[model samples]
Target: MYDSGKIIAGLIVFVLLVTFPFISNMGKASAKPKPSIDTPVINEMAVKKCVEPKEFMRAEHMQLLNNWRDSVVRNGDRIYVNTAGQSYNMSLQNTCMNCHSNKKKFCDECHNYMAVNPYCWSCHIQPKEQPNEQPKENML
Candidate 1:
């Protein structure tokens, strides 16, 4: 019992030190980012829809992509039919990126926010993004 007070003080200090990060960052989390889908192809579409429903894609896109990779590589299958019975090509670049041209806005925003480093680009090539050119007004 001679060192009981000192032991308690050291334990409190250690607990505070361990919990400093949680205490310091309380209620300071950033808002979830909303990815932009303002590509010309999507703009031209009458109905703005993806290969699957928005919620389905948001939750199961990784699994869907993995299945697509396996289907294409292993079985040489290139067609994907959605739940709505609509057929789509399984090419990520030609199909997905064809509409989602703004990678920084569409893909990077969510990926960065989620702190994920997806290895899709290792085997697949990332589509080249065209620079967003603001329309210059003609000076009279």
Candidate 2:
């Protein structure tokens, strides 16, 4: 015959274990009111597409870089110009490639090992390319 005390203790423990999660979550449910479809929201900022910095370089970002390069000021004056010839005031410190040198030092070493072809070389110059190369027809 099973002990009566033992059976009662087992039933109490089982009930407590089953009820623990519900008891813990009861406070959270009462704390916040759920938002419905009719709720009014105010958003002032315009939505903009986000792109990674490396991916941005791979895309048609060369134009932006060119603009920045042209707008560099030798003096203390802060003057900037856009592609459309509009003048503005902004200071561009350096170019992107100034930091990322090679695949091993900056890009390729890591990406090559990972077997990922970063499209950055498409728009930007590769690290290994020579500064000057004669045309094939001219060479011959």
Candidate topping TM-score: 1
lDDT of candidates 1 onward, in order = 0.86, 0.44
Write candidate 1's Cα lDDT for 1-140 as tens digits: 67999999999999999999999989997688889999999999999999999999999988999999999999999999999999999988898889998877898789878778788877776666754643132111
Which stretch of 10 consecutive residues in model 2 shows the poorest summed lDDT? 35-44
Model 1 alpha-carbon drift over 4 Å, by segment? 1-13, 23-29, 130-140
Alpha-carbon deviation at 89 in model 2, angstroms: 12
Q: Assess every candidate by TM-score.
A: 0.79, 0.24
lDDT of 2 by residue, 40-93 (tens): 111222532112243554565545545554555344444554454655554222
lDDT of prediction 2: 0.44
lDDT of 2 at 136: 29
Q: Candidate 1 clash total?
A: 0
